[model samples]
Target: MAPENSNTEEVVVGEEVGRVRLITLNRPRQLNVISSQVVSLVAGFLEKWEKDDDAHLIIIKAVGRAFSAGGDLKMFYAGKTDDSCLEVVYRMYWLCYHIHTYKKTAVALVNGIAMGGGAAMAVPLKFTVVTEKTIFAVPEATIGLHTDCSFSYILPRLPGHLGEYLALTGARLNGKEMIAIGLATHFVPSEKLDELEKRLVSLNSGDEVAIKAVIEEFSLEVQPDEESIVHKLSIINKCFGEESVEEIIKSFEAEASREGNAWIASVLKGLKRSSPTGLKITLRSIREGRKQTLSECLKKEFRLTMNQLRSVISGDVYEGIRALNIDKDNSPKWNPASLNEVSSEKVDRVFQPFEAELELNIPPEGDAYRWSGKYENSVYPTLKGKQ
Candidate 1:
């Protein structure tokens, strides 16, 4: 049944075929952004399926070139000043929490672009399958937002300082890199996705072994490309492992001066151009995320995000949206524009606890390390190429 009081026609569609319940994001024209309406539609179906015994497993995909671009920026632009906007964000956070600790087996078919909130949806699923056409990123820093959607918990668990590097610079990864970084479970060609989906839906049991067996039948062995950033793990660790953002930038500059590494140069450019306050807070968030539980990370992120929207100390987020989406001018006038002008104290202010009324009411229940420890010691049969 379609959701009522909606202008769109079940833009978020959920249908059951045998034991599989497939949910698709249908807003292709909008790049399938996770708008509030989409959230309501998707969340409603998910809640319904949670009680349906016939829905043995769930598969989420999109009917476009992008699984989802991110949260709807236009909505943010319109409600930047309103407290009600946080209501949608809170809903998204809870949905993410539900996805992480979901009872049923979950699979995400990430065939195209999945950035920011989109990455959050797929990264926590029990099975994440990607295609050559897949592109993944969490470019929140570029828009003066720290990575949210429980990404803080996910990123720090990535190998070495790669998480810190990505959080600060807003780097991107292809499907191959995603597997290398353990973000994706399997890689199948775009052409083979339909066959894989058919096989997955045919499975009557939600048993992990049975599902893995079905997925393994269609998984491919693909190597990361020559120019992959993950290939520069050593350089990434050396620079991003620094104690402070200043030290990291200096390290990058030193490397750029000697080796003239184009990648390092580009990273430096991105960091320097991004909102200074954003870079500082993101670095802190990732560092703290390494120590915190999934629930803790989400709570902290909710506080920080609310702070950004509220603009208690700075309004870079609003400026970023205006520059990037509304004005289309591609220039954000960041307050305290330069990194030198942003102090550690200001960064600390964002992480301070919110009042009881403003705190994210997520239950303490979760499997914090559920996804982490599984892939660390054992390499998947198909992921041998990644080894």
Candidate 2:
């Protein structure tokens, strides 16, 4: 292991126990943020294990209250135009691509907060386990950043307008909700995770059935929290499912005025607090993502991310990073000031394809969606309106 400093061990640790190869994120103090060192270690381990004849399965876990908070925002805070930060972004995209097309049976035991880049790591795995302690979100838009790490490909596939709702509002979902939303394969209490890991490590076969059977032995049925926003499916679809952000907010306001619903009021507050430009671009990203392949989405997202970092049109990303992280002010002066100030032309520019050298490259096998439909029935049916 390469030691970067006296205080920090290698941020990622790889170990072989029986037939299973274990990859653990080791940075707990910083909430296991993805730094360049972590990326290098993960890439190395994945490469070595892929070629190892004895490795039958790959399991990823973390040692912290957060699986990972996201990419190291501090890196970008230095300057988005910094070449070093750009390199990390490119490496992160490749890592997401690798996880999607991994040859081994990939399982992730996700506990605690998994947002943005962390969710990217967990969501594409062949099997993902979560505990009640797990909380997941894609809050990029809230920080004036669009979602990346192949989320463009994954989010649009979620039921109804849930994906759009999440991208726009940065909603959080607990572990049970993760399974309900098809983001995780199994649910086990946090206390049982150790026992589950032992059982998983004992499995010697590559047969998916055997692997699933082992996982199921530790899995249990879990109900979402009583106050889950997902319970408001009709309202969510009615508002978020609309054609445009302005239309959706107007619908919410109209419904709130008629019915006096507190939830709608709260959602409106969140929308108003977020960066207008971020919301407009995020909506466009998820909508266009509906028709794009994973590879195509990643390529498109790469361009968008580069532009976001460069702060070409608006410096909202820089302003956001300052307010949320560096300054800790909780106040951002979003350029253009309001949603009405953003134009479709500006959003279109963010989605434009990148030049040849800047585009993300994926392996031939990574071009297709490889999901096995295991969690297809997870989402509950949407409420039908009265005739």
Candidate 3:
């Protein structure tokens, strides 16, 4: 049913799909950039739908030009440097945490671009679908920020050194590329997307084997295109696996000098422009993520995100928001005063826990982690063919 009232929330709509309940992202105008309002709407709906006996399966998708342009930068920009900023960030983190452990067969339809915080919405589902036009990326570094939410959990699980490359460089990919990297399960042509979705829903609508067979049909035939980024896996692992951010930068510099490659040149420039705090923390996050369990990584991310909020107002984050969103100025004066000055101590702080209690703002009523320790080993799966 179409919206009939002005009372619809900017972020969501709740409707029935046969016995399934579909929670759709509704902010088409903003490309569904998330805010606290959006977060609350999603969390609230999922929480409710999880309990609804009528909901046979959950279908999560977005309606927009781009599935989501990411967390609303304009809203984040408006609240920058204030306590409200931390509160907003906290709320978002809480939302992702809720969705991550949700027990149902939640699916994300990547009907368009999925990047940054928007990428957060797609990667945690039971299965994620991408249309031919779907473009995926994590361009957080370009705007002087780190990838937050539980992205750190999913990215490392992707096929190879691709996660590291994608995180640092903010390279975008189409649906076929996402499928290649194990980031997406199915790729349907945009015109055939609706029909494909109905078929998927049908297989899973009742019979388990039928569902598995349909999944196998999609999963069975993965095409190995000659032009895939698989060849660059060697370069990505070597550069991203260096000792520190400085070493990584040095590696990129060396690569650009030797190869004179356009990609390396862009990476070097992107590294220079990224938030120092974001870069250091990301390096640490990915490194720590290798050994960290899903629960540990989520807790660690919360710990890190909380600290990033309270350390100081007008901190590196401020300069990040200012340069990227406020002034429209690509130039940001990253503190520690200098690249050399951004010490190990400063980097350490991002990993350190915040003061006082470790209270999560979102109530832990039905968190999937609260139920079982099944997935709770300290170490996660490692990337194959990459050290």
Q: Estimate each model's TM-score.
A: 0.90, 0.90, 0.83
Residues 1-387, model 3: lDDT tens digits = 233332445568766656666677888877878877787677777777777666666777777668887877776656544445555565566667667777666777788978877877787776777876688888775555665677777777775556666777677787777777777777656666555556656644633455445544544344535645555677777887787778888886787777535567766777787776677777678777777766566667766665555443116665666777779777888765445766777777667664334434334454444422211121112211221
| lDDT, candidate 2, 82-180, per-residue tens | 544666776777778778878888889998989999888888988999998998999898888887788888988988888888888888899899898
TM-score order, best first, reads: 1, 2, 3
How high is the CA lDDT of each candidate model? 0.82, 0.80, 0.66
The lowest-lDDT stretch of 10 consecutive residues in candidate 1 is 371-380
Candidate topping lDDT = 1
Root-mean-square deviation of Cα positions for candidate 1 versus the true structure, in angstroms: 9.3
Clashing pairs in 1: none
- What's the CA RMSD for each of the models? 9.3, 9.5, 7.5
Query: Which tens-of-lDDT digit does each residue in 308-380 have in candidate 1?
Result: 8878778999899999989989888999788878887788788999766456666554445322211113222
Model 3 lDDT at residue 13: 77
Q: For every model in order, what is the number of clashing pairs? A: 0, 0, 0
